[model samples]
Target: MTSVRVAGVGLTPFGDHGDRAGRDLFAEAAAAAIDDAEIDRAAVDQLAYGNFMGALAEQQGHQAPLMAEAAGLDCPATRYEEACASAGVAVKAAVEAIRAGTADLVVAGGMERMNCLDTGEATEALAIAADELYEVRAGMTFPSAYALMAQAYFDRFGGGRADLAHIAVKNHANAVPNEYAQYQREITVDDALDAPPVAEPLHLYDACPITDGASAVVLASEEYVTANDLDAPVEITGVGQGGDRLALQDRDAIAETPAATEAAEVAYADSGITAADIDVAEVHDCFTIAEAMALESLGIADSGEGIVAARDGKTTPDGDCPVNLSGGLKAKGHPVGATGGSQIAELTRLLRGDHPNSEHVADATTGVAHNAGGTVASAVVHVLEVAE
Candidate 1:
């Protein structure tokens, strides 16, 4: 199989883009990536785009061709929608295409204009990612759904608000230096604990904000990279995906996401790297509780020990392993479809020693990106390393 590498990455600052269309945002990111790769627009062989709720958010569908045209690329284009894991899946497809010798150069990314909808409308649109009959019909929004998970985690692990508060504080601090982050201000644990409650055990600070953004990456086969002399490319060593029951209630353990664990396992196996070998990571932290669960799922911490790791500073930049140097979804913003691409972009930047955060892991060589969709029903994990 052919090896794949990320030659370039780009992203628009994640926030409320009042009137910006998803296509326009994606075009900007795509162009930036193309420029960063120093590749001609006509050289892109294919495009893999991810967008969730574009039809509902903007009453637009069939966005693949539209985005490709907007980016000035005349190429075959396809869209992947797996809720928040959309971009992760898109990246996986691009990698697979290159490995299979189907395409030598591909532009893969995601975009979402979630701010176009009102609060209630946005809530409804996001809820559609869950099991409509079992989860959404019961009037369970994401915050409430994850609130139950938070409560269950505390019940099983014996931690409370203060434990989760650490995640909010740490991620907020990390975001301060990230210009592309949605929330750049630092907050204290008290600020997180005192914030208005969105759900019991889950405060406003625990939840990621409603955001609109886009992120893109240029991927090329090793053969193409060598021929084109692309500089400082980051090799994609492993990619894995997993799925589970869609409804949160169907899982035997509400506090855990087996899909994430399974995906990480496959990625680690493919890369010949263990959890301890990962110098840094970017995981889905849609909620503070989600981050704790992700840490456990990714095997960075044992079951029910993720909160302990967070509180003990084990996951901080100066700790055993730095997680979410990009501020994660909590502070960097979660644009649903765009988030996975953003995560990969951040990891690529870190591996290239170009991350905006000065606190990024020193001499980091290996990194992992974990992206989940809709209550962890679907997940994708990728292991990346600096070119050897």
Candidate 2:
């Protein structure tokens, strides 16, 4: 298989992009990525875009071709929508194209304009990712779903809500330096613990906010990189995806996600690296409990010890293995489809030694991104390494 490299990455600050069309947001990100790659727009052979709720959020469909045109590129265009894991799926497709000798250069990314709707409407839009017949009908919003998981985790793992608060505190602190993060202010564990409840055990501070943003990456074949004299390309060493039943009620275990475990196993095997070898990571943390579950699912900690890992600072920037130095979804904001691409873009910056966060891992050479969709029903994991 031909090696695939991330030649450049770009992102728009995640926040309320008032009245900005999703295509326009994506176009900005795409142009920045192409410029960063030092490649002409004509060099891109295909575009793979991700957007989870364009039809609902913007009353728009068939966005791929529109985004391509907005980016000033005339190429084959495709869209991948796996809810929150949308951009990860798009990146996976771009990699496949490069590795199959089908295209030398592919522009892949995701965009979401979720703030266009009010909070209640946005919640309704997001609920569509769940099993409509089962979960949605049961009035299971995302926070409520994860709140159940949080309670189950405490019942099984012997930790309470305070342990989850530690995750919020750490991620908020990490977000302080991220200019692109939606919330840059730091918070305390008490702030998370005392905030009004969204769902019984989960507080207002425990969830990621509705965000509108876009992110893009320029992926190229190794041959193209060498021929174009690309600078400091980051190699996509491994890619893995897994899926499970969408409804949480049907799952055998609510505290742990088998899909994430399977995806991580495949990614590690493909990359020839283990969790212990990962110097840094960006795991999905749409809810604080989700972060703890992701740590265990990715094999960074034991099943019941994820909260302990966070409380002990093992996952902090100065810890042995830094996770979510970009503030994570907790503070960095979650734009659904765009989050997976944002994770890739952040990891690329970390590996390139240019991330704005002071907590960035020193001498980091390997990084992994864990993106999950719709209550962990789907997951995509990618391992990236600095080009040697």
Q: What overall lDDT goes with each candidate model?
A: 0.91, 0.91
**Runs in model 2 with CA error above 4 Å?**
none
Candidate 2's TM-score: 0.98
Q: Write the per-residue lDDT of candidate 2 for residues 1-388, one digit (tens) a residue.
A: 8889999999999999999889899999999889888998998999999999999999999999999999999999999999999999999999989989999999999999999999999999999999999889889999999999989888888888888898999999999999899999999888898899999789999899999999999999999999989984589989999999999999999989889999999989989899988888899999988988899988888889888777998998888788899999989999999999999999998888778863457688889999999999999999999878
Q: Over the stretch 65-138, how does candidate 1's per-residue lDDT look in tens digits?
A: 99999999999999999999999999999999999999999999999998888889999999999988888888
**How displaced is residue 377 in candidate 2, in Å?**
0.7
